[model samples]
Target: MPATYNTDGAEDPDLYAQLMTERYGPLRLILAERNRPAPPRQARANLTPDPRAAEHRHQLLEALNNRPQPDPEPAA
Candidate 1:
């Protein structure tokens, strides 16, 4: 089934506004709120570095350096 039921005709915009105002109070206040500019967003600054990042990098470097080496050649 369709989500919205088919209506015979389009609803009157003014009547809809009046109904909404009756239910929710003043349309002007609602319209003003809807049209108002949003508050400015705050910029997030990293005040401190992550301590674990350095430890992880150190562990990775140690693992890379400690890889197995080839055996030394025997006398001919």
Candidate 2:
């Protein structure tokens, strides 16, 4: 049998949203969240920075810019 909604994969937001809500269920949230009001944001974070963030950033930059990088030293 032919597949239904073969071209209905996110190309058209309206159709995709309908299909998602129907095929999933009323309990399927986030679909209804489309173009809706912004959910409340947290006032502040209780998070700490990862010590390796700098290293990861340098590695990502080098990879994206097509360059090799030396090991990153600890930040002051």
Evaluate model 1: give its TM-score.
Answer: 0.33
TM agreement with the true structure for every prediction: 0.33, 0.31
Candidate 2 on 1-76: residue-level lDDT in tens?
Answer: 1223344447786687567558865432544455478989998895888899999999998898886668899999
Tell me, by TM-score, which candidate is best: 1
Where is model 1 more than 4 Å wrong at Cα?
1-17, 44-76
Clashes of each: 0, 0
Model 2 residue runs over 4 Å out of place are: 1-38, 43-46, 67-76
- Local accuracy by lDDT, each model: 0.70, 0.66
Model 2's number of clashes is 0
Reference-based lDDT, residue 54, model 2: 98
Which is the leading candidate under lDDT? 1
